[model samples]
Target: MASKQAQRLAARQQLQQRMAVKAEEERRKRTVLWSIGGVAALVALVLVAWGAVTVFGADDDEAGASDPDVAELVDEAEAASDRCADVEPSGEGALGTPTEGLTDGRPAQDVYLECLQMSTPDASATESCMYTSVDGTSPTPLSVQPAAGTQKMTIVTNLGTITAEIDTAGAPCTAGSFTYLAKEGYFDGQQCHRLTTESIWVLQCGDPDARGAIEAGTPEMAGAGSPGYQYEEENLPVEAEANYPAGTIAMANAGAGTTGSQFFIVYEDTSLPADYTVLGQVTSGLDIVEQVAAAGVM
Candidate 1:
């Protein structure tokens, strides 16, 4: 009897010890799982906060005009749009400036956002409308009264109320550059030196003086006095379907990706592959272009 009792006690003690070991292991596993989840949640929160800061923080001037490739692209598009102002819209032109207030949660709102996002200045970057918003209550809906600032307007030579509707929507950077330089009087009294009627149809202006017909325009006389900054092309209208008829005010360049203080006016519609920036068409004073052309490099 004693031996049997001792054997039973030993068996019970072994089983209890085994159960304790198993329980300890399970507790450790639960603790480890909880700790891992906490770390993951913390990481996710940090990322979300960082993204918000980047989106809503104060705009950086350097970053605002950042992206050299984009600036060059804007220059080309603006120039091309200018030269092709009278051209009709084949489809779309360059990619438009991205507006960020469009990511609403609703399907239609999201679709509208997608369309705007996909909207290109020309058919080259064609995209279809994905959604439409009827109620305007989409998650990414723009504010009814958002802050769209009035860009500064600068007239280089007071071409007598040279009225123009600045295209603030299409090329903000380029527009801003022009306005900034103009307000600072960078192009005051600059002469229209070059008039090419063959491959191009424009009377290029912005030479400080038009004394002689220099073969290659010098930097001092070329469109060189702007803010020394360039912009990428945005929201270019199709050349074939543009509103700028003949006698349109436009921008000119020396070669590809070269546009600055110089401006031009189209007298005839000539087909050229080179781009000219169609900033704003002369609403009232197209006669000025004709007069300057008649005067020729004086």
Candidate 2:
């Protein structure tokens, strides 16, 4: 009876040892699976973070590419002659000297004889007109007035070339300003910053301090650059329905007599109150503007 009892005890001890080994093996297997899952999750998060950085980095690069440096344009401006220094008006109806209170919005007498009359066959029948400024300051004084006739200018751009005709008959002052600025290479290396497709179908350009070129969150300083002077409006439409037709090139201004270097090209018949100076008409390259407009703003 003692031998049988001892044999039973040995059998029970062997069974318990086997069960302890099996439990340890199962615990190790579960630990290996948990470690693999953790590693895989970390790899997935890394991939997602890399993808986000790549996508956002690409977008920032594209924006930088589109916005050209304003410093380049400023360098061009500095190379030109300082036409505003010691300036004096020239031509038949030029001001004898610079005067104050000219750009005061309200109608004032032509103090400096800056007002001119268009010469006609009957010289006595010429109507008097004034060249007003925005801040009561003249732009680099045009030493000479533009000759009377349809002056032609070729606007070369990266996209295309635009040919325009400055109508000296209708807008002599505005034409003269453009002629002077073009000669000084002011418009070179400049891009059209603003494009409005709806309500106003036009492409505005000629801001030396192109605010668009600056990165986002930077203060904008566009549409504020000038040739150190301003001019009055000319050739405003008489009839309300006399809209600026497609291909019409006109000046952009802050208000009355505030014409600056910025100008807009009408891609479609746009109805705007005749507040802006009618600079000229685009003879060619209207299609280029239309194509740009079709692509829409990026």
Candidate 3:
């Protein structure tokens, strides 16, 4: 009887902690968003935003892509799971998919909102973060704070080497993951696979499996790749009209908390729903991405 009582008490406490985090996220959403839409184009790039299919959201039936990863994470009281299942959407979500009902695959838009809901600070973590292990191959990130308030990420391409200034202040966990992945030589020879020429101008890269299929002249056969572990989003620009501006680099995921190695570099000022996590600014090598964008997608 005493053990059961203790278990109940513990469950109640966990629920309260989760609710507190969700409430703060709601408050942040209510605030912080303003108009940065008319910021003017730094370059004559594209318009519109990345839709569900092509960008971060995915539809997979593999065991690794099951619902347990999201719903059960919170139910099991995992430290990293902020319990986004309980979050109520502020508006009619991007996909209008029901967060409550599901038969097989989850709606991409719903996954996106879940990402937004849990994209806040833990306030209870040590330096090391327990990124959800997916394939047991992801490298653990170093500290989010490197040096000079920002860390430098150099991307050497066939065209030219592009350098970025990772904003650790904004997305510390993401920064750490990037650092670890880079050290492990994860991005060694991976091709920058997806490039959008229409309204959204970006060079999407980092997918390990995006090569052969795309090169075989069948782009549709390409699959989404991950870093083997997963982590929730952080440093969301939920308030900006042009949330992703020119020279911005951000993560690409299949849904909320499904962030993988894939990322997009914005060569234009774009406004998508504030679902993706902003990594930092592409301080250099914007020209390289721009040149590729100008040439258009193959």
Model 1 gets an lDDT of 0.42
TM-score per model over all chains:
0.43, 0.53, 0.54
* Tens-digit per-residue lDDT, 182-278, candidate 3: 5445665555666665556667877766555555766555446777888888778876667899999999888899887788889888888788899
> For candidate 1, which ten residues in a row score worst on lDDT?
109-118
How many residue pairs in model 3 have overlapping backbones? Answer: 4
Q: Write down the TM-score for model 2.
A: 0.53
lDDT of 1 by residue, 220-246 (tens): 343343334333343344556334456
What's the candidate order when arranged by decreasing lDDT? 2, 3, 1
Give all candidates' CA lDDT scores. Answer: 0.42, 0.58, 0.58
Query: Candidate 1 vs candidate 2: which has greater TM-score?
Result: 2
Indicate which candidate wins on TM-score.
3
- lDDT assessment of candidate 3: 0.58
